[model samples]
Target: MNESNLGRREVLDEVELKKLNNIRQKKLNQMDSFEELSYEQIMKMANMHNEILNNIHMSRGDVYLYSENEKLELVEDLYNTYMSDFRDITLKQVVDFSKNVAGVEKSQDLLIYDWEKMYIDQANQILFDSSDIGDLNMSLDKLVGDVKSDNRKMFKTPILLYIETLKESSFYWASVEEGGSGLGFSLLKKRSPYFMSNKKGKKNWKNVAIADAQGMTTGMLGVAAYGAWGVMFGPAGFALTGGAFVWVAVESAMASALFG
Candidate 1:
């Protein structure tokens, strides 16, 4: 292995390299699924408006008829679903650029697997008794159908659609009180490779890290912008922020798409 001024390379044993290779292969498979699945298909599976709204409520810890444990579990399930989709969408793009555009294989992969069906099942089971959150079950069932169906072709490359899902899913993940902070940070760090590898994204991941940190600052500012209005104007401010869960997601989604 050779080291460059860009970053030091650590030599890995054959076993380590093989494990990493396997992980990258899995990412390729997930990416294949992501490309086949269209934005319209995902939308048809679930109502984005409601998903956004419900996520806001979940973030505020205001979900009804569910215990803290259940809320945590449900939100985790949703988070995994979004991340699975994200890895397929984002990492796939990175890998493709490496192989096709750059004539190189970056050899990147995520520890996550595409368990879309498992996520749907867990969500349904968690919300089985409640009618309110259960409304989301329709979307979940739709997603299950999309996952199970052999024919999935909604659009060629609806880049923004997956971004929307990623943002919304992260919102839900950040809603849970237990591991919200950790999950959010993990997501941002793990996803840095997309920017590091893609032509549109940052070439230097260190810069991506800096941008992500700054994004957190701006994200808080976005929260304050909405929060300040809510403090003075009441319902109208709440309307803009959508009940406390609308912090910086729009920016994050835009940033992800542009950087990816």
Candidate 2:
């Protein structure tokens, strides 16, 4: 071959080699992630996931026969168990779980928040309207319907809000459970999906957390003052409960100041 032709051939070979290397690197990363997860870790994730799923189903009725305090501990234990095992969850793992274990077409089915969208939207609207307590409870009951519904998208905002709320006040669930406030515990658990997504490393963790916090706090005080917490937990009930529930009281006071 002429010198010019030889040089062109070398350039083409180099480009092809680079592409092959990139593909190999991707496969290596995938294999490493798979091998990094132990059988115990996989079982742990699956067990916790199943617990959450059962909780969602139980939330539909009075099947949870334990005292409010017991329920609180149950939820906290579940959170700790899941968080302790938090690792980068891959799409392949989720798919495998869905197909092999859940017998569902999509992993999203297993990830659903178990609540209805219309109820959440309506309850949120009423919370900001200074509505009567009866109305708020009624709306909540409607939102947490019997059958498991698939609305993971609708839960994103609520999960983010709950995370921001929890990050600011670590003992929120404990306080609610101590105070025997079933409504509060149920509300706190709504943030489960955010943690699930975090485990999977779906987005920039810092960015997702900050955005969730900002979104939850933004204009929250103004709307909260309209008797949202009060309606949900009863007049002065949330304020009386100390510890993590303090987040609610603080926000409620700020909201009261803003909208009053």
Candidate 3:
């Protein structure tokens, strides 16, 4: 393309980006009026997400093995009984358990978070990077094998977005469970293929957290929104999860639990 053509393409890209951003912002605004959640509510939100997972048959176990206030005597028995369950998820106990079970190193204690990110990043690279098989090409099974052989998370963007969608769906499911509002699982269940490509439908979120991060899907923009927080007040948007994919549930517009 000529320099003039290149300049035009860049302008087009910028315009497209702005349009996507506006759609995302509108969806995020829905949760702005919600109040902050309490500690017990946080626990319930997390547990409810796990319960949703159980119903879906994605995983075998259920959550909520430990309560918010409890004296846990650390012992072989404790480890044997609850290690499989991530039972120490309430408040300070979560940190303490991570430190104990994951070992003494500071990074080691945050291994679960690190591991989750590592997988997501790798998936994004593999699906979106354009260097690998997905030049809109195929050969994912081969690339997956290479991750163990060469040891890398490689893929293209759309596929990575897909991995993100599956990861975020649980939290959205929990939001409706918490009485936040919107369509919840009914909405989320139908949108999985859309985020992978406009041909399939639209965009959506890949994460959810209450703190300084973001997830959830945007049906309008067709691109994933992450790395920012969209707060959900009251019993909605589980706080312990660490980010917010705040609102968004579809294509014409992203729906979510209306706060305030």
Query: Which candidate should be chosen as best, given TM-score against the real structure?
Result: 3
Model 3 C-alpha lDDT versus the unseen true structure: 0.28
Candidate 1, clashing residue pairs? Answer: none
Q: Tell me each candidate's TM-score.
A: 0.22, 0.19, 0.23
The predictions' CA RMSDs to the true structure, in order, are 21.3, 23.4, 20.1
TM-score of 1: 0.22
lDDT of each: 0.31, 0.28, 0.28
Show model 3 residue runs off by greater than 4 Å: 1-91, 95-122, 125-141, 151-185, 188-201, 206-260
lDDT of 3 at 210: 15
In the predicted model 2, the residue pairs found to clash are 221-255
Greater TM-score among 2 and 3 belongs to 3
Question: Which portions of model 1 miss their true places by more than 4 Å?
Answer: 1-23, 26-35, 45-60, 63-160, 166-260
**Candidate 2 ranges with C-alpha deviation above 4 Å:** 1-120, 128-130, 146-148, 151-260
List the candidates ranked by lDDT, beginning with the highest. Answer: 1, 2, 3
For residues 3-119, what per-residue lDDT tens digits would candidate 3 score against the true structure?
111000111234544453455456555544323234244334334333333342232221122222211221222233333344433323322322221121111111123443454
The TM-score, computed over Cα atoms with residue i paired to residue i, of candidate 2 is 0.19
Cα deviation at 245, candidate 3, in Å, is 25
